[model samples]
Target chain A: MSLVRLCLIMLALLALAAAVAILLGETPLSLGQYLQALTHPASPPGEVLWTIRAPRVAMAILVGGALGLAGATMQGLLRNPLADPGVLGVSAISGLGAALAIAGGLAAVPGAIELSALAGALVAGGAVVAIALRLREPEALILFGVAISAFGGALTALVFNLAPSPVAIAEILAWLMGSVENRDWTDSLRAIVPMAVGAALCLKAGRGLRMLTLGEEAARMSGLPMPRLRAYAVAGAALLTGAAVAGAGVIGFVGLAAPHMVRALVKDDPRRILWPSALAGALLLVVADLAARLAPTDQELKLGVVTALFGAPVFALLAWRAARSWRS
Target chain B: MTAAWTLNGVSARLNGKRALDAADLVAWPGEVVGVVGPNGAGKTSLLRAGLGLLPLTSGEARLSGQRLDQLTAAQRAGLVGYLPQDRRVAWNLPAEVVAGLGAIDLPEVQALILARDRLASVGAGDLATRGVLDMSGGERARVLLARLLCARAPLLVADEPIAGLDPDAQLLTLDLLRAEAARGAAVVVTLHDLSLAARCCDRVIVLDQGRVAAEGVPGVALASDVLARVFKLDGALVESPAGPVLAARRL
Candidate 1:
């Protein structure tokens, strides 16, 4: 299928998933009733829809798209399919930042934890980029990311150990598992601008990313400014991943899986993969969120938990195939 | 008149060892100059320095009488086209698309047409729609050569352009480079097959240990004494019916 047709299908699927998520909440509503609530105002159902479901759905799409675009950019910049947003240590540092906010009793504040997570992500991403500038090798960049992730993980553990209360520890742990639960318009608004900017940056860098598929020397010979392109790609990915993590916690696997899935369907042109991967990301997250809500258990499953459960096996299979090809 | 590309007193160190030591060479338009050397003799470094892809430690490389470092990246690309020794395609893009990458700044339609024409010139017209990942080494080399040709730069620098190709493909590549020179482009290619070099090149520069050992017409540069001294081989330049051939055996 053409890339445009596939993207349209993904968008339609996303709309359908959003409808299901809105209609099948704790107090289920029929299609007619939902339409009435959407069209009419000053009704209890309308109020519930506006105040709850709309923001949550918007957040899911934004976060998912952000992570997906970031993943695609990371993979292209590194010239490795195994790269993802988390590979740069953004998500882990974001988690550490949230843990600190929770342990410090700042969870009661409206945007404090989100702000902290964003800060942490930027710092980690910046550090990785600084190191990458000095060390141009892609493998070395990933190794630095691994080291930063370990540091962030250790920091989060220390926060857990020093938690003031068991309730605070539970909240921090649950947040790390990732969710869009109870997010309001404020959260959605906070994430949208940065995500838009980041996506735009990725789009601008897409042509260079495509050229890079020819390898660094060839791309440079073709007139691409290597240092500038690398910087833009890294910063764009950081913006996207940081914004997504701030809004919805550290959601796992969407960045890795969305781009991979889209590449399977479309040509692997890095420029061509950006938007479809974003749509696939949104589609993946909405479906995962819907599954989380529809599970038979009394409490909903975490979004990260569901995505990892589904995405890890697929990733493992891809890695195995890539390794086999390399060996042969 | 300024040469198409020139390296004057150029020195470079790669991985903490001297790769090019005050190497001086000039390539003019309307000629194909072949560089020949044994392993680790800095042929790649000479090409790279001429393209300004490597920084000179002590001297300058120029294009059209201007220092390479003084030009913008786009300007440099417009002046010199380069093909590295390692040909790697990370994805399964079509051959046409890969060739079009050389002229990425052009409009899609123009670039595609240019790519197709280049592929056809190199006898790779049938492989335009084929995936590069599916191509054999020789086919890939042809496609990549087409890409370098698509750049249409005044100077083309290629490292080991016919390394893995069969004899026919090797001749085809040499012909394509000659054709580029016929069109007023200066073609600089590093070659391992001395016989091909002798048969094809307008001039040959023999390198030994990061410096020029001998340079002139192919017959003079590949003399028996230079071959024995630089390559450690007992050899002679035999006059075959086709041309001068370097017949050599290990010492």
Candidate 2:
């Protein structure tokens, strides 16, 4: 049942990605023309369709899927529905990394920003785990994450402030706001490998997580080494966050909102819900990106702004429902 | 006939506090041992330490000649089943799914043995599809007890297994434990109900202030003036329909 839904959702997202790429630009193409563009390799439309729009569409899927999977994985590990890389300092650190690369003029070398973003994500993720380890309570770890995220945000602002040119600041700001515009196949490849590897590792660790949900002692009693299992899950989240942030500056809510929404639908069966979560996350980002591109404005709004606008209210509704249900 | 477990001067400390002090115990196979104690008397600590769930400050516990820590969880899993106090499982899962957890490695036939006989034994056969969170306290207790039995381990360590259970469920749970011991498992349960302990257990060990205050046959152990003194109760035995029951009245 879940597999069929996942396939359909992936197909729908693929359709949306193609639509966003082909129809949202200066010269909008009809479905027939889009098909013409997709097929006719020797024509100018082929280069325009394949080169510019295809890579952007591909990047959207990869970044969206990565964020969604990572978000769901984070929620499962922490047992918190609201947890995501953005709220937990992952994207802020990635922003910091991207800023440093741009501010230091290293993006001229190509892939520097991606590397820096990955590094920042790793550092932030490691710091969260370290802080979580130090604290006696899970709530303490969340609070500490907020504190770390604030610090990273401040550092990011400092790096942006020190940029030598307005162009650099504009680029950094736009990237931080997150968009799939002007991306290429090279960028998609940079993100896909790490995200795929990370998601695979998370799937491998899913069984251990089921044992973990039974509580630490039960997990230990069930033959799981808690420390190692936690490390693997944390590392997987960090890697996925890094890849997504590296691919796009920081798309928010895909990580926090996706898994919770999936759980809300699937009824919290972790083993069965993983792919649904990943696909749902991908579909969310694709739709959000499409909205960002197609909004009837002179200038395109940021993808993050669209997702946050859509996701926040939905998340609030869910939270309210959860709270009300919890009371009952 | 064989000793299922032996503790040699086993001690446990938690955060610099001596929770259990130099405890020695021998659990013979196919015997039901009940541990009774006042609150904070280190009863749970002793069981947890013996099961190798907690670190021992000193001494050691052996399970059928094997060091407790040396056994892998799966290997030890085959030897002992431990049910802790206040097990908080997500109630959204069905009872059978929770029961399925205990049927980890046993052959299909053995799993069937548990599902059929043990569920009926604990009076939880009707609750196979019910959600644990949705069940009444008595029902959840029966299901959990059934899960413990499904492990088919040689030893059972249950901390307050009958707390919050209704009288009928409590009796049925005890009866199930007795049947488990008859199947050649050493069953150790920490309990608050003195009458249940007296009726169900072959032997009893009472703890007070982190030490074994008394250990022996239920009647003799509960009859000890020392237990009355430590428990600060007007201890008396009542002849009940079930058997001779210990009645502890407030001093």
Candidate 3:
């Protein structure tokens, strides 16, 4: 399909996904009732729609979009298709920060989770930055991110096992697993500013990232400053990932899935894939949230689990194809 | 004409081993300088150091009278373009996109047009839209050559640029380098082909064991005695109608 047609399809799917999410929740509101709740705020359906579902939907979309754009930015900067916010330990660090806020009673204060998550993400992202800068070859940076991810995961598990209360343990586990079940507009409001700013920065850095696809020597000759550009991209990725994690706990595969799927749709042009990836990511998470809310099972699936279940196989297939293409 | 670059008492050492030892060289505007050496003779190291990507162990290299390390990335970019020995395209991005990236001010269409015009001057226009991944080795070389040209910098440093080209393409590549020099750009290329160096470069530097064994016009630098001692080959310089050529026998 042509790029324009593909973009139209992506947008249409997003709209459909949003509509389906609105109609399929546990409250079982029909399309008309949901429409009434959204358009006519004073009606009987207003409480159900405005109070609970709207915020949930908005939170899902915002967090998903953030993860998607962050993933795309990371992949482009690293020049490695497999790189993602979660895979580099950025999310784990953010989760640690959120857990600290909740467990330490900081969440009693308004807006603490967001600040805590941002701190965690910055710390984790900073470690990756330091390591990437230390390496001479780009491949070494990839390895370093992998190492950081593994170490971060271990640290998170240790912290969870040491929780003092059953409630604390459950919250930590739920956050680690990733969820959007009880999130409201406040969560989305908390994240929107950083996500928007970070995405804008990523888009501005898109041109430089495209030049870098030709390798460092070529990029330098094309007028890119290696050290500064690398720092800019890494900071952009961290901010986007940090905001998403702060708002919605730690959604794992959205970042990995969104960028890869968008690349598949748009042919790996960084400039073309930027916004589409964000939109598609928002769509995917909204749909996943809908499924999590209304599945036949009593226990709702976590948002992260749904994405990981769906994303891992598709991601593997794309990665295999990429490797084979490179080999040839 | 002003000197585009100069290296004085410069040396490069990697992993405690001397890669380039006390090398002194100067390239003027509109000059074609070729460096020839064996595999470990430090041709790539010298280019990297000169470009300020690598620091000199001692002494210094300068671009347009400013020390290379003192120049900002943009200032250096306006001064020099470097093509490393290995060029990789991480994705199957279109070739025109790659070349157009060097245009500082034009839109993509205008950049492509300007890049194609420059490529056409070097016999490389037809391959503009081809994917770098799908191209043949010679075709990739030409595309990268187009990319190098698009920089429009005063100095061009290409390391083993023609290693993958066919014989005919090799000659065209040399001609392109000559044309770049003729346009007032300082051109430095490292090559395994002595004949191409002898035919194209105004001056040649021959390196042996991390030091300059010979430096001068190609005919004088590639003399039989130097080739025999430094390159371990017995070579004769024969006067052709066009110029002097080097014919060598394996040691």
Candidate 4:
């Protein structure tokens, strides 16, 4: 299929999923009631749909798209199919930031938690790039990222250990579990600009990513500015990942699975994988969030928990297929 | 005309060891140059340095009478086409897409046409739409050769282009290189087959232990003494119907 047609199909599916997500939350509404509620803001059902569910759905789309695009860019830059945005420790650091905010009594303030998370993610991303400047090998860069991720995880644990109250610890733990629950328009607005900027940068770097598949030596021989391209891709991915982590908690597996899903449908060209991966990611998260809402448990499952439950099996299958093809 | 590519006293280090020690060579347009050496002889290093892909620890590499370092990336790409020793494609992209990567600035239609034409020139036209990873070793080599040809650069630097090919494919590859030379492009290739080098190259350069051990016409450069000292082979130049051939016995 043509890229345009495939993208259109994904967009349509995303719209359908978005509608389902908005209509089926704690206060379920029929299609007719949902439409009526959207049109009339005075009714309680209408107000609930517009003010609460709509923002959550929008957050899912934005955060999912950001993570998906970031993952595709990271995979292309590292030339590893398994690479994800979290592989560089950005998400873990973001988690640490949110933990700090909740532990410090700042969670009561709107946007404070998100701002802290974004700050932490940016710092982690910057450190990765600084280390990458000295290390030309992709393996070395990944190793450095792993070390940073471990450190961030330790810090998060430290925050948990030093919590002064059970309420603060519970809030931090719930936030770390990853969800778009209770998010409002303010969260979406805060994330959109950085998400858009990050997506644009990743899309622009597609050409360089295509050339990079030829390997570093061949890419240099082809006249590609390796250092500049690498820097741009890493920084752009970090931005998207940071923004997504700030908007939602550290949602796992969307970044890792979305691009691979798209690659199975389209060609493996890194340039071609970006937008499709983003759309697929949005769809995946929206559906996963809806499933979380509909689960039989009294309390809704966390978005991150639902994704990991589904995504890990899918990832294993992908790995198996890759290994099989390689053997043949 | 100025030499198409030149390396003057160029030295490079790889993994803290000298890979090219004060290597000096020149390749001119309309000539085919063969670099022959054993496993650690710095043939790959020479080609890489000549293409300005490797940083020279000292000395200079020049192309078209300009210092290599002075040229921008795009300019360097326009001047030299390089094929590294390893021919692995990490992704499963189509062969045509792989070849079209050489000239990404062109329109899609133009790049596709160029890629197809180059594949046909290398006798792998049917493999254009095939996945690179699915092809046999010989098929992959031909496709990669087409990619190298797609650059249409003034100087072509191919390291061990015919390493895994059968006899006929090997001859076809050599003939293709010679054709590129005849088209006024300087072609530099690394070869392990001394007989093929003797038959195909206009001039031969023999490297031993990261240095130029011998260089001149094939007969002079591949002299038995040089072969014995460098390759450690009991070999002699012999007359054959095709051209000069190397007949070797166990050392």
Candidate 5:
């Protein structure tokens, strides 16, 4: 299929998923109310649609797309099919930040938790920028990310042990489980700038990734700016994951599964696969979030939980297919 | 005419061992140059250092009279097309996509069309749509050859261009290199088969122990004494009905 058509199909699916997400809340909104909410600001439907459902759905798109694009860039740059945004540890570090903020009683503040998450992510991002600029091999970046992720994971478990109250524990665990609840336009606005800038930078780094397919020496010989491209891939991926974590906590699986899903539909050109992967990611997250809202349980399902449940099997199938080449 | 690329008194090390020791090499447009040596002779190192892909421990390499350090990536791409010793295509991208990578500055569609044309030139036109990993060794080599052709650069360097090919494919690859030279691109290749080098190259450089043992027209460079000293061969460059062939056996 042409890239434009593939993108359009994914967007259409996103629209369908969005409609379901908006209409199926605890308040039981109708199709008519949702459509009416699009323009009538004074109506009851407008309040729920504009202030509640809209922002939540918007957050899913932004987060999902960011994670998707980041995954594709990482996989391309490292030339590892199984690579994902979380491989760099941005999510775990940010989770640590959000958890600390919750334990500090900052969740009540309008944006304190997100600020902490972003601050945490930026530290990891700083390390990435330094390593990508100074080092010659990409494997170094991977190793550093693994080390830092372990540190963050261990520290966050400590934070859970030191929580002051059950309420604080519940709030921290809720955020960790990942949700778009109570997110507003401000959160979406905050996430979009980084996501946009990050996407632009990652997309431009395609030439370097394409040349790298020829292997390192040949790539350098092609006159590709290997250092600059490395910085772009890591920095772009960092900002993207940072935005998602800051806005919606740590939603999982979308970034890891989106690119693998799209590769089945498109040729495996790193640059060519990015856009469709992003749209597929957006669709995946939106549908996953809708499933989170509708699951038959006393408490609502976490977006992260729904995504992992849905994504793991699909990802396994794609990865299994990919393993065939290793055998042959 | 001025040489297209020149490595002057270049010495380089790989893995803390001397790979190229004070090597001087040059090639001109419309000529096919071959570098021949034993496994440790540093033919790969010489080409790599000359192209500015590897750093020089001493001496300078220049392209178009400008030092390698002074050349921008765009200038380098325009000047030389390089194929490394290990032909690793990291992904299973389509053959056309691999070929198109030669000219990434162009739009994807334009690059693909340009690559398709080059693939046709190498007589592997049918391989363009197939995934490279699924190809046989010979098919993969031609696909990579098509990638080199896609660059259409003024100077072409390939390491072991015909090392693993059968006799028929070997001649076809050599003929393609000669054709590129005919089109006025200076083509450089490393060959293990001395007979193939004698038959195909306009001039050949014999490397021994990381130094140039001899360099001249094939008949002079591979003549008996140098052959014995460098390759431990007990023979001479003999003219057959087809062309000059290295008639030798292990000493």
Candidate 6:
């Protein structure tokens, strides 16, 4: 299929999923109420649609698109198909920060925990980029990121272990499990703005990533600014991943799977894969969230858990295909 | 007259080892300068160091008479293009996409047009839409050549341009390089194939142990004794249907 056609299909799919998510939440809304709610925000049904479903849907879209775009950029930057937004450990670092805030009794404040997560993400991004500038090999870049990710994950767990009370522990654990439920407009804005900036930066760096398909030396020889490109790619991904984690709390699999799902449709152009991957991610997350809502269980399935259940198989498939043809 | 590209008393290091030392080479416009050496003799390093890809440890380099260090990357790119030794591409992108990457500053459509034109010039026009990863080594090499051509810079540096090819493909690449030189670009290439170098190049520079050992026309620079000492081999220039080729043997 043509890239344009595939992108349109992916966008249409995402829109359909989003419409379903918004129209059929805990309190199903008739088409009239859906339109009426938009017109009257103060009514009870309006509050459910606007305050509950709409924001949740928007949060899903923002988080999914951010992660998917970040993953595609990260993969292109590293020249590795196995890479994702979390490869640099930014998500875990942000989670650690948010967990620290929650355990420190900051969950009462609306945006304080997210602010902390953003701070942690920036610090981690700087540290990783500092290490990246000195490293001569891409393998070393991955190794450093993996190390930081492990360290962040361990520290977050430690924070969970040492929470002052059972309530703090539960809050931290819930935040870490990842979800987009019951989010408001303010919360979505917390992520949506930074994610937009991050997406723009990644898009601008797309051509450099395209040049990288020729190999590192050739790309550099082609006059690409290596350090700047590295910084932009890492920083942009950090912002996107940080925002996603802040809004939805460490959703995985979408970043790893969305790009791969649309990769064949785009002919392996890293830059070209960004938009389709974002659409794929948005679609994936909306559908997953819907599944979570409608599943026949006592408690709702966590968004992260559902993604992992499906993403692991995709991960295995990607690994299998990567071995067969690195290009494809 | 100012040379198209020049490296003066240049040296470079890789992995804490001296890969190039005080090597000097200058290629004028409208000429193919073949850099020939044994394995690890620093031919690649010389080209890289001179092109300012690898920074010089202790000397100077220039493109079109402009000091390389003073030139912005874009300015340098405007002056020259490079084709490194590795022919492997990291994606399954169409050949035109890969080729258009060289001219990315242009609008996408214009770049693809230039890339397709370059592909046709290299005789790989039919493969414009083919995925580079799916092509055979020879076909991919031609696509890479098209990418190099897409730059359309006046000074072209290609390392080991004819490595790992059938005789016909090797001849095709050589012909393309010569064609670029004929179009008034200064062509620099590295080759282990002495016969092909002697036949295709206007001048040949021989390197041994990180320094230029001999440089002149192929007949003198690759004269028998120089070949024996530097390359540890004996060689004789012989006439073939294609051209004069240097047939070499172990010492």
For every candidate, give the share of true A-B contacts it also has: 0.65, 0.18, 0.60, 0.64, 0.71, 0.67
| Colliding residue pairs in candidate 2 | none
Candidate that scores best on DockQ: 1
Cand. 2 TM to true fold: 0.88
Ranking by DockQ: 1, 4, 6, 5, 3, 2
Better of 1 and 2 by lDDT: 1
In model 2, the runs with Cα more than 4 Å from the true position are A2-26, A100-105, A109-112, A123-144, A158-169, A225-227, A264-267, A321-328, B106-121, B136-138, B244-246
Clashing residue pairs found in predicted model 6: none
Write down the C-alpha DockQ for each prediction.
0.69, 0.36, 0.62, 0.68, 0.63, 0.67
Q: DockQ score for model 2, please?
A: 0.36
lDDT by residue for model 2 over A107-207, one digit each (tens)? Answer: 78877987898889888888876765445444565667778779988998897778899999998888888888888888888788888888887787776
Model 2, CA-based lDDT: 0.76
Model 5: fnat (fraction of native contacts): 0.71
lDDT of 1 by residue, A1-328 (tens): 7878988988898899888777777777777778879788457788778788778888999999999999998788767676776766778998898889889999889778878887787787677757754664555776787788889889998988989889998999888899999989988898898888888888888888888877777888887776677777877888888889878888877988889888967667787899999998988898898788779887789998998898878768766766564443
Q: Which tens-of-lDDT digit does each residue in A1-328 have in candidate 4?
A: 7889989999999999998787777776777786789788768888788788889999999999999999888788767676676767888998899899999999889778877888887788778767754675555776787788899889999999999999998888888888998988988998998888888888888888888777777788887676677777877888888788878888887988999888956778888999999998999999988889889998889998998788778767765775666465
In order, the interface RMSDs are 1.1, 2.5, 1.7, 1.1, 1.3, 1.1
lDDT of 3 by residue, A83-103 (tens): 778877788888888887777
Better of 1 and 4 by lDDT: 4
From the highest lDDT down, the ranking of the candidates is 4, 6, 1, 5, 3, 2
Task: List where candidate 1 sits over 4 angstroms from the true fold.
Answer: A1-3, A30-36, A100-116, A119-148, A162-168
lDDT of each: 0.85, 0.76, 0.80, 0.86, 0.83, 0.86
User: How does each model score on TM-score?
Assistant: 0.93, 0.88, 0.91, 0.93, 0.88, 0.92
- Candidate 4, residues B1-251, lDDT tens digits: the string is 99989999999988789999898999999999999999989998888877776779998999878899899888888888998887767677788998998876588789889999999999999999888878998998898898889898999989999998999999999999999999999999999999999999999999998899999999999999998999999989899889988999868
